[model samples]
Target: MEIMQSLTDGIMLGGIYGVISIGLSLVFGVLGVVNFAQAQFLMLGMYVSWTLWKLLGIDPILGIPLTGAVVFIIGYLIEKTLIQRILKAPPVAQIFLTVGLMIFLENAVLLIYGSSFQSVVVSYQSLGFHIGSLFISAPYLMAFTAAVIVCAGLWIFLSRSWFGKAIRATSQDSDAAVLCGINVKQVYALAFSIGVALTAIGGAVILPYMTVSPSVGGQFSILMFTVVVLGGLGNVAGALVGGLVVGIIQSLSTMVFPVQLQNLILFIVFIGILAFKPEGLLKEK
Candidate 1:
């Protein structure tokens, strides 16, 4: 039963990681850009949730829409004002732009929030339910559920909606999509916006499990990037799978390896995957 509880906890954590990484995959898929600044977006979402819950007394769940709306608009504006102009330039431009964005957002956030760590002081977090004699934190369960809904919504948007299809078409071949009267630039902007919004949602949902700090976004960025690559760049399903696999590895490592070395286990697996199947388990169309 102790073992069972640990396994359950591992799976729950992995679900959150997988959900968080999907946005990274989506942005890479459509924009052909490695958005190093994704961490800042995650931070923004978390900060908003912290603000709402810790400051305004709103629940974190209720803050989702507020965070999402803010990040979505910021994403759209960022792309329109800066990213769109460099779409046709070399890929290096995207990298540089993203790096610049990383510095800007980080510094801006520090100036706004300062270095003080923030957390939502909720008493319910300590409360947990036992399944088969294993304790499960309420926050992990909540995070898992929220992550699923958000990812499912993204999948539906990509598979069912016309604009989603347009994004897909553009991802496959932007020139061909253009011939079909799809506005490639518009699709890119919207896709970036949606992708950033995903990270925001993740931040808001997982705040209960994590403390808010400027540097935390950088940590999320690395984890999400690993998930994106393992899942395959541009492959949403692959990212999901990759996220779960990473979560499992991380969870298991706590038992088998030293606490400090747990992160290394994930790196070993990720490198193995990259070497064995660079395209990922599920290749996007």
Candidate 2:
């Protein structure tokens, strides 16, 4: 029963993890740039949601669209002004640029929001339901549901929309896409914007169960990377599978290992995957 409970919790947590990591995967897939600053966008989303809750009396969960929109605009501007310049630079330059962006975002948020931690006080923050002996957390369930909806929507957008098809074409071969009349630069900017927006939405959904601080993105940075790598860096569907695998590992680890060692275990899995299957559990599309 205890194991079953952990599994349930893990699934809920994994769904959110998958959503957050999908943006990272998408950015890398389309741009061929590994964005070290992606998690900061998640932090930005959390702040957006928290602010809406505090100032406008909006529920954090209810403010997800606003959070996503705000972050999406920020992402679009950043990609156009900053990332677009480095798209063809050497890998080291790209890495350094993103790392610098990550630092800037962290300190910028710190300067504005200060060092205080913030969280939302939603009505269902502490609520839960039981199915026999297995308990499900209300916040987790809501976040998971939202994550699913967002992912499904993304899949439809990517697979069906005209712009989505253009994005896909650009990802497969930018030069070829250009020859075919697709605006490759525009696709890059849109893809980067959408990628970060998805991550921010993930962050907003989890506000009920997590606190937001400037450094919170640091906590998720490594986890997000692990999920992306485990699923395959550019494989969107793989990210979801990786998230489930990671969430289950984390949940079950707490049963036998100290809470402090949870990350240690994750690090081990990450290392093992890199060593054995660096291409990831899924083949790149």
Candidate 3:
């Protein structure tokens, strides 16, 4: 029973982690920018949702569209203002830009929101249900459901939409996309915006299960990176696979290993994967 419980908890946790990784993976696969500020974007998302709820009493789920829209503008402006200039530069230069952006965004948020921990403070967030011998928290269950829906939606959009084809074209061959009368620049911005929107939605989904702090995104970001790499670089579906595997690994590790030590399972698996199958479990598109 205890083992089963840990597996369930891990799946729940991994689902939350999966949502964050999807955004990071998308941006990296398409634009090749690591976007180290992904965590900060996540923090900003949590802060926005919290403020909206506190001031106007808006439901967090209902505020999903509003959060996505706000972050969408911010992300698009970021690419237009700075990232676009250094797009042709070396990958290391791009890394520095993202690092600086991460610092600026995190410090700015800390200055404004402080280092305190915040939660949505909803009643049902702590509640759960029993399905057979398994118990599941409402927040975790909801996070899992939302994660699945968002991932599914992303797949459908990428596979079915015309804009998705344009985006795919840009990702595959930007110069070709430009020569073919497609606005590759616009595709870049649009792709990035949709990517960040996922992070915003991730923040909202995990609010009930985790505390939102100015630096919370930092912690989540690294784990998301590990998952992204484990799933293979540039593969969106791989992010889902990697996220669930890492989640289950960490959760189940608690049975024999200390709780804090569970995090190592991700990196260990990551290293093993790199050592064996460098392309990851799935080939990156």
lDDT of 3 by residue, 1-285 (tens): 988898888888887778778888888778888888887888888888888888987766667778878888999999899888777899999999999998998888889888889778776776989988999988788778888888888888998999988888887888898899998778888888888888888888777667888778767765887788888877888888888888988888888888887657666877788789888787865
- Residue 271 lDDT, candidate 2, scale 0-100: 97
Candidates arranged by TM-score, highest first: 2, 1, 3
lDDT of each: 0.84, 0.93, 0.82
TM agreement with the true structure for every prediction: 0.95, 0.99, 0.95
Best candidate according to lDDT: 2
**1 or 3, greater by lDDT:** 1
* Inter-residue clash pairs, candidate 3: none
Supply the TM-score for candidate 2.
0.99
Model 1 lDDT tens row, 1-285: 655665787788778888777888888889888888987899989998898886688777667888898899999999999888887789888889999998898888899999898888666677788765778788888888888888888889899999999999998999999999999989999999998988888899889878988878877776787788888899988888888877877777777788788667767776777889877777665
Model 1 alpha-carbon drift over 4 Å, by segment: none
- Poorest 10 consecutive residues by lDDT, candidate 2: 57-66
Give the per-residue lDDT digits (tens) of candidate 2, residues 1-285.
Answer: 899988988888898999999999999999999999999999999999999999998987788889999999999999999999999899999999999999999999999999999988988999998889888889899999999999999999999999999989988999999999999999999999999999999989999999999999999988999999999998989999999989999999999999999999999999999999999999785
